[model samples]
Target: MKDTNHPLPVIVEQAELTLAGLQTTMSLAHNTTMQLWQTFGPLKKSIHNKSNGGSYSVQCYADNFMSIPFTPETKFVKWAAVAVFNEDDIPKELEVLKIPKGKWAVFSYKGTISDFGKFAQYVYQEWLPSSGYQLDHRPHYEFMASDYLGPNHPDAQEEVWIPIV
Candidate 1:
């Protein structure tokens, strides 16, 4: 069921990471990604001992997440964060998430954030099912750096990271 236009992902092994930022409960139907980033973006300077990898937008799904269709009400934790060297001095307003080293599939995409639904649909419904790798329980995320042009810009580019076993 692979679509000829679908982009393939790059499989890689990533090291463990400790991220410091803000988290919220949300779903596709109730997406607040823009607002979250809007609030967190300027605060990045307040973070200490951060990594040079830029900003990380992470989604932590429930254990049964992949087993069922992703509905609007399907709740998950969305974190707007940056990698930190350690959790010793986090801002009181932010929390830390420690991601263990794991295998992941990285997809590079360029488009407005609003247009990402189709891309995700293709990945989870087609590419993932057809590929040999299964979704791992770890969190999924997007990495955006100097190239990121913001949410509304169609030229915005980011690397989508999907945890896989």
Candidate 2:
């Protein structure tokens, strides 16, 4: 694990996504997200719009957001989504999520996905409190590139975006 004390930089942008997944508690998030990928993978071609900066699969955590403490019992929504050029013509089974323009603390994570919890712990429990920034009311997410390998792949890389104010 690398030093998570420092984040990359803050960025603000509007994101349009088409997601298909489940609403689960923190304890079940890992398994749930994996299941989401398995279910969404075969449907990727159908859900993605080529004009929307290619397809970027994402995991969005929302619900209580920053208003409540994060625990195993906390409920949140997790999605396996692809970016889309337009909101029209969305598949009936999928849900659309728009991440409004806001500041984010972007952290580059390199390693297996299973270790992500530790990184997140560092970010929320340590980094955020001391960084002089407050958590913004938005979905926290992870942006995985199209070429991303599975959780155990050694070279896997992803960016964890924590919405902040």
The worst-scoring run of ten residues by lDDT in candidate 1 lies at 1-10
Write out the backbone clash pairs for model 2.
none
lDDT of 2: 0.64
| Per-residue accuracy of model 1 over 15-73 as CA lDDT, tens digit each | 99899998999888898878998888778888878877589999999998888877888
lDDT of each: 0.88, 0.64
lDDT of 2 by residue, 73-157 (tens): 5555666767666776666766666766677888788888677777777888888887789987777777777687767996888
User: Highest TM-score: which candidate?
Assistant: 1
Backbone clash total for model 1 is 0
- TM-score, every prediction: 0.92, 0.78
Cα-based RMSD of candidate 1 = 1.7
